[model samples]
Target: MPSLWHSIPALLLLPASISAVTLDCKHIRVDKQSFDLSALGGPKTVHQLQYLQPSISNTTFTIDICQSLKRTKGVPKSDECAGGTRVCGIERIYNQADDSSTTERVIPIAGEFSTSHGRAMDPEVTRLKDSASNSDSELEGLRVELHGGKWPETSGGSLQKAIIEFQCARDVTGNEGFEDAAEGSMLDIKSYGNLTRRAGEDAQEDDDNDDDEDGPPELPDLDKGKSLQFVSYKPDSDGVGVLRLNWKTKYACEGAYDEPPSGGGSNKTAHWGFFTWFLIVTFMLAATYIIFGSWLNYNRYGARGWDLVPHGDAIRDIPYVVKEWTGGVVDKLKGSGGSRGGYSAV
Candidate 1:
């Protein structure tokens, strides 16, 4: 017989519910505040965002939040993201001698889609607090981190990560408006690269250790005017490459937190309390015991009427027993005493 541990992998291979993905923006709760971004995930559509880098390999990062991205038309499904992918990064490498690009690398940064052979980590969601906001009591922004993306062993051992921040910008309409308003700060992406080299000596050394030309990039802090842009992509010492992006939208504003739907109250999910569950279980157990016992009595001894019920005598006497006990208590309270201080009869 195979060892029990050997079967563990088979057990893990069992079909798992698709909802295991880390973040579900539809019912997100942070610090007692709830948010619903289900609207952003259009029907059979994903909210797509793209970032381009022309210098090092015509690299493009196409991403979607809250929904999987669809493959491009005329492109083989294998060339793009697999089904259920939320973040996909493509790098087209051009030949140095000829201006034509001959090679392409597909990097699945983050996604919920998985296969029997492998599964990606569910997206991680966190809160980003903005001290400047007046609603300091609630979260001012949201941070979503995706994991389970790994570079080939030949490329590097680091797992790819994507961290997207949604900041509150009440004046902005949505991602589209934010993207348009962010054109001025596009140059910051290159400045951040220089900053990365100066940030730490180890990062420079690590870059040389790996042949990947497009080493992990980094993002600068949110600029004064930019509403949407790349943040950073720095590989950690522990072999994790993180790509960060920021998007400002009114939907992330404080007013958006747990706002009731128009023309209706919030539909809070009702749950039974501990006592309620306990009573239900107790009743079920009692009913089961009584039904089983009655069936046994009927079949085994031909019992009828009250005799068919187990402990029927004790149950029938319960009312009388309570009455007698109540009467005794009342008599005791009245006191078996004679007139004045005379002794009471035994």
Candidate 2:
């Protein structure tokens, strides 16, 4: 009979069934266009938005496009969702009688939260039709779908999902904390219906809200915002939760990532610096002089050992020469021999 240890090797050899999910915000490619969102993902940065319904419930959505959100303090890695988590939602419901609040659930809306194998399905990228295009023939926005988040137990057992829409904004940054005129960032709430309904309505509302010819729409403030902002969260008939967000950044504009060519004959130029050229020239000159001198010493004088090297005597006496020079400098600094008396030297 085989021992249990013998069976462990076979299990170890088995291939993993899970697939890896890649979230490269710096290089999000959609058709002919590419987006770089490295600006939003700063060191120790988490873009968060809060929603509160007075005396009922409050919710907060936290997201990071380039990396996993920082792990919660004092919480074990296993207990809190950290690795492979791009977007998370935490909802707290308040008691009607005493105004006491309890956390309803913490949902990892977008990302793979597996402790063992770090893998997930590819995020779905699609072209979105919005007011920016104005015509149905041209789609002006981008949509990214990320799912496979660990579902809360309250739901039968379905993975959490999130959809992010990239809309063009004139401003580079949307954070009110960073910008003076900017009001707020996001709006997180329950979805009244489908995503299309909200997007279509909001576009028309923006036009109506535009007070000045050159100024932005007069929209209400939510909180200090980022390029990515929460829109709504709705569960399907099967109780699977889906969250939506709107991203407004210059990167969403057409041809934002149309980079110039990087090959030869381009207008761009690259040249060695003065210091680099100096080092190269000095090294070549020294090498050539040594080679020529060494050959001359070998062929003309039949030199051997250290004699074959150019300036071999000086090179070999470097240590002794330096020692004598250092002693002389020290003696000079010491002022002729210690002092005949303590006050003899000034």
Candidate 3:
């Protein structure tokens, strides 16, 4: 026959039937050409730029700035730009060349810009014409730089600060373009908009109110033990998702204190009651034994007297003799009486 311990395996198996819920995080995209930088328009001149590119999920990305050789001061170093001066400025670059050089030199374009304030500014694609003649091949590397400056001041101001953005994508030309070939090759663009230090301040204030609205952590009841169990599940035929956890009582003090008594009474009360009952029963038994013993002795031997006497003959049966000198004196007295009668006869 199976014992009670055998049923525990089945009891433990009961909680395994519970199902577990799955959670996943995805990359969401936003559609907005330029983030507003008017919030940053103040006494301090603010230069803003935005760009877009592909980003690995939950990772920090690096943005690069590339200057076109057409805009440089020498012969064309790269095919994207013609022979010109290569000028890379943190912010603004002045174009002082003549009309011939200006026609030969391609204009320096602005890259994407981002800041810690979570705002971004992307390049305006409509401002420039597409010069890529090849349609089928991929555009290996493209760079853009952003310059901020005022009309009058030449240098040394907030305009001096500029952000550059870079991105990599397939050349959109018609020859070998992924779209033309019917392959689902994706073109990912990462964007960094202009950000101000004061961005998200209102959101932070709302966050403070939310913090105050949130309640305190719930306290577990110390009285009852909670029974909980965890189970694993397979979401797909390949058995990809699996989880494990312990099944046990969830009493707040189970691990902290001694086990409570089975009875409802407090420990001290139970102990005192047990001792009292024990003493009462012992006293009763002792009293009963004393009374029963006295009754038994009275019934077995009543009050009685005992007598003792001697068993021997009387002393008068023994014989005795007188001394010989007393007997001679009696004989002399009789002879003297006879001698007196003879003297009277003479």
Tell me the lDDT of candidate 2.
0.57
How would you encode candidate 2's per-residue C-alpha lDDT over 143-222 as one tens digit per residue?
77887675654345566787777776656543424343322222222321222234345555756877355422222333
- Please, what is the whole-model Cα lDDT of each candidate in the order they appear? 0.58, 0.57, 0.25
Taking the tens digit of each residue's C-alpha lDDT, what string does model 1 give over 1-346? Answer: 1243354354344334423646766666776666666545531211212123322244456666677777566777656666766776666543323334422667677675456216576665656773445464265777777876765524545577788777777667444533443332223334534443443344455566774664444433433454456555668787677777777766666557445545787633212233555775676576566767877887999887778778999999999999999999888877754354776568
Model 1 clash number: 5
Off by over 4 Å in 3: 1-139, 146-166, 171-346
Instruction: Give the Cα error of residue 316 in candidate 1, in Å.
Output: 40
Better of 2 and 3 by lDDT: 2
Query: Candidate 1: misplaced stretches above 4 Å?
Result: 1-21, 42-56, 94-99, 113-117, 130-139, 153-156, 177-227, 260-346
Model 2: how far is 198 from its true place, Å?
28
- Candidate ranking under TM-score, highest first, comes to 1, 2, 3
What are the per-residue Cα lDDT tens digits for candidate 3 across 1-346? 1332354354444333221101000111112211111111111111112111111111111111122122324534431221211211122111212211111222222221222212222322210112253531232221122332111122331221122111121221111211233221112221111111122333355467786663322222211221211122112353222212111211111111123334554445335545866886676565455334434444564311111001101212222124456667889987886785456763
Q: List the candidates' TM-scores in order.
A: 0.49, 0.49, 0.13
| Model 2 misplacement above 4 A | 1-21, 42-54, 75-82, 94-100, 114-121, 129-139, 153-155, 174-221, 224-227, 259-346
